[model samples]
Target: MAHYFVGDIQGCFAELQKLLLKVDFNPSKDTLWAVGDLVARGPDSLATLRFFQSLGDTGKVVLGNHDMHLLALHGKLKRNKPSDNLTPLLNAPDIESLISWLRLQPLMRELPEHNVIMTHAGVPPQWSLETLRQESQLVSQALQQADYLDALISKMYSDTAERWEPNAIGINRLRFCINALTRMRYLFVDGHLDFDCKQPPENCTNPQLRPWFDFASPLRESHTLVFGHWAALMGKVNSPKLKALDTGCCWGEYLTLWHLESDQKITQKRLKKS
Candidate 1:
């Protein structure tokens, strides 16, 4: 049973299917790890959500920013962007079941045998592995609670990067956790999140800002991190310790799958966006 980690799908269901077929994946045996964005900015959002949701026992997804947005809107926790196109998921025949299943997915997974940690985006430089584990559970608890709407509200706000003081578990703390898990890409010199920088490291004027995986990164000892948020950085950043899978598939780049064990690369069949 091979484990294949695929890139951001972004509603391209056909491409995903072709890529899985190329690897000869069997639902009963092989495991597929998705670097989220399972729905958004493409034509088949509903179909994509349904397909991944149906994977049930075989699939795993680390929630992306867009995926969190879908969850927020799906649960009525936030307003949708005018450019956001999630009508298909909202109107799907099994939308409720799909959303419930999606809510159960963990924000981070550490495969000890593989020594790779998976999250929708990079882990915060300040967090220790133990802290991440504790907070992930706290976030999961918040997600599973009666006031889940409140939790989702806190989870979607990425602008707040306040430090975790004491046992921080309130709304602001939740926002910090969500941003670290889903929207983080760069860090300010003070190690605070620089959430506004979307440009590559080379172009950014803020010398204070640094990509999440700079080899000497503060969190390097935690685990081999696998993340996918910076489509601007493209695939397989040189931080050899870090593995990025978002091959910009939604932007006409080929979707990619990297086998964790052998480091073999697989590309999905492309259907050019017109």
Candidate 2:
């Protein structure tokens, strides 16, 4: 009945299996909390999607940037990047089912008992817990609505605003929500997203930019935050309340699986080099 939280799998099926074996995970009992990026940039996107989709209630996944991109490119093979390795998945017979399931996945997961919120990237510093939940539901509803899903995914890639405004509406608001929850990493001192800085905090030459968690904000400090977008950090950051899980499994680094209750890490090496 142990809960295992795994980092960006990026379609590393073999490594995922190895990590599950190392942890002795049981589908019928144990729960798997995936920190997103479930598909893309690896050898077996189709197999990975199928496995997770088959998990049903046993597995929970938050949509990562890659997952969203996959949905956006559905029925349009020419738009997908070759490096993403999404062709096999797009060609699968059950591709529609997989895409539908992924669309239904939420952008954030709140673990009430653990007092933690898990997202693909860090939560926005400005959002309160209630606001976060409300925003997530709004976006989730838009994605699940077949009539509005394509339009929402098509406009989600924009990050031009740099900061979120409560008054923002329509595509701008959806883009803001998508960026903060899926692609956020660094932030300006004024709490605006800084998309230019992908380097770790120590490597950043600009004092104006700080890791999202390092910003002096109440939402970040009040509860535990588990995120996985910054592989360059290698799960190292200067915050007791934050846990980074992405170890660059897609970049030929180790796949990390952290046990929430005991803070134990289980790792497996990548089979292919990036």
On lDDT, the leading prediction is 2
lDDT of 1 by residue, 173-206 (tens): 7778888888888877666777788887778898
Best by TM-score: 2
In model 1, residue pairs whose N, Cα or C atoms come closer than 3 Å (at least 3 residues apart or on different chains), thus clashing, are none
Candidate 1 deviant stretches above 4 angstroms: 162-167, 215-219
The clash count for each model shown is 0, 0
TM-score of each: 0.92, 0.96
True lDDT of residue 26, candidate 1: 91
lDDT of 2 by residue, 1-274 (tens): 7888999999998999999998889999988998899999989888888999899989988989888888877945339889898889988999989988898899999778878789999898888998889888888989978665556866676669678889988778888888899999998888899887888888999988878887666777678888898999999978777889999988999899988878888899898655
Worst 10 residues of 2 by lDDT: 146-155
Q: What are the C-alpha RMSDs, in order, of all predicted structures? A: 2.1, 1.7
Model 2 root mean square deviation, Cα atoms: 1.7
